[model samples]
Target: MYKKMIKNAAGVILSLSLAIASCGMTVNAQESKDKPSVTSNSLNAGGRVSKNQSGATATTTFSRPGNIRAKAIVYYRLGEDDYHSEDVKTNNAGGTTAFAEKKVSNANVVGAKGEHRVVYGDIIWNDETHIGLTLPNSKLK
Candidate 1:
């Protein structure tokens, strides 16, 4: 009876271990499926002093094609003006496709101080209609 009990206990332990491991894997798989799909280029400041940088590019790949939007805080210095920040919205019209991308440009150059700087403060994607997770900042050029 003692030997039989030992064997049964070992079997139960093994089964429990397998169940725990499988549960962990299932959670990871679900997380991956829910992850958002988005990519972008570092903010680009364009032209010589007094000229506006065209704009940065954003690329996105969704599991399903749908309209998506992202927001970025753009820090810029135009010509001789003091550096300032603005929140800009960029969008993608998936249009029944799984992939969509856009290059957003603000061509308003208000000064000509011959020097300019562009930095991205923060960027976030829309989980649905509102902002979702904030993306990591990339190295600026």
Candidate 2:
């Protein structure tokens, strides 16, 4: 009877040890998938997707608070010796936003002094005919 009782207690201890180890392993499994979870608040403002004035999307999100400012600027050379620009302001929660142009910017106009066409390589001129997408990261990407 004494030997039988000892064997039963050993079996119980072994089962409990296995259960406890499994619980610890489960916690780490969930963490692995959590870190890479992309928080797109900077890319999409709440629920609004960015739109490009050039009729093309140039939306992009960098690892914020690490590699970007709360606000950013994108420049497009408008004409001779001039440029058009846009600013993407990070929301109050440190999330940057994109313009309808899908370009990130601050509250200023900063265009690049290089040669590039507007989105689509086509245009319908009017008073609102923009020279190009306010922020053109397509080529950069």
Candidate 3:
């Protein structure tokens, strides 16, 4: 009986190892092939829209092409004239699919001048429709 139990345990472990080894580890973005196609991209200072007198500086756009209902998050870099430069996240609102920002051309971190990490601030992907902290003021302003 002891020998039989040992064999069974070994078989179970081997089976479990094989199962885990065969599984994939990538994020499958779709629940079903029939669902709405989903897709995402980074929006830059100028692409699909133009900054106008009505407070429109930049615009970002993305699409979910899958049949399944999908969500998108856009990280925004906040910049204003009278305030220190910083970054924030916001969701798409009110018939708007584009993210507009004043653009930070000269924003940098403390003690990291000349370094990409210090100088360049990235607008991270917060969630579906951009949600993050606001940025600092624009030096150009």
Which 10 consecutive residues of model 3 have the lowest summed lDDT?
A: 111-120
After superposition, the stretches of candidate 3 with alpha carbons farther than 4 Å from their true spots are 1-94, 105-130, 135-141
Q: In terms of TM-score, how similar is model 1 to the real structure?
A: 0.22
Per-candidate TM vs. native? Answer: 0.22, 0.22, 0.18
Q: Report the lDDT tens digits of candidate 3 across residue range 60-92.
A: 232322111112211223333332222222233
Runs of candidate 1 exceeding 4 Å displacement: 1-52, 72-74, 83-141
Instruction: List clashing residue pairs in candidate 1.
Output: 46-53, 79-113, 80-113
Ranking by TM-score: 1, 2, 3
Higher-ranked by TM-score: 2 or 3 = 2
Residue-level lDDT tens digits of model 2 in 1-141: 999999999999999999997885655643343221122332332222222224122222333232222222234332333233344443223334344232333222332221111111242111111222345442231
Query: RMSD in angstroms, all models?
Result: 16.7, 18.0, 16.4
Go through the candidates in order and give the clash count of each.
Answer: 3, 13, 30
Q: Candidate 2: where is the Cα deviation over 4 Å?
A: 1-69, 92-94, 100-141
Q: Model-by-model lDDT, in order?
A: 0.31, 0.32, 0.29
**What are the per-residue Cα lDDT tens digits for candidate 1 across 1-141?**
999999999999999999988885645553444232332233322212111243222223232223343322222333333232232332333311111111223322121111112222343222211112222331122
> Which lDDT value does model 2 have at 60?
29
Deviation in Å, model 3, residue 61 alpha carbon: 14
lDDT (Cα, 0-100) at 60 in candidate 3 = 29
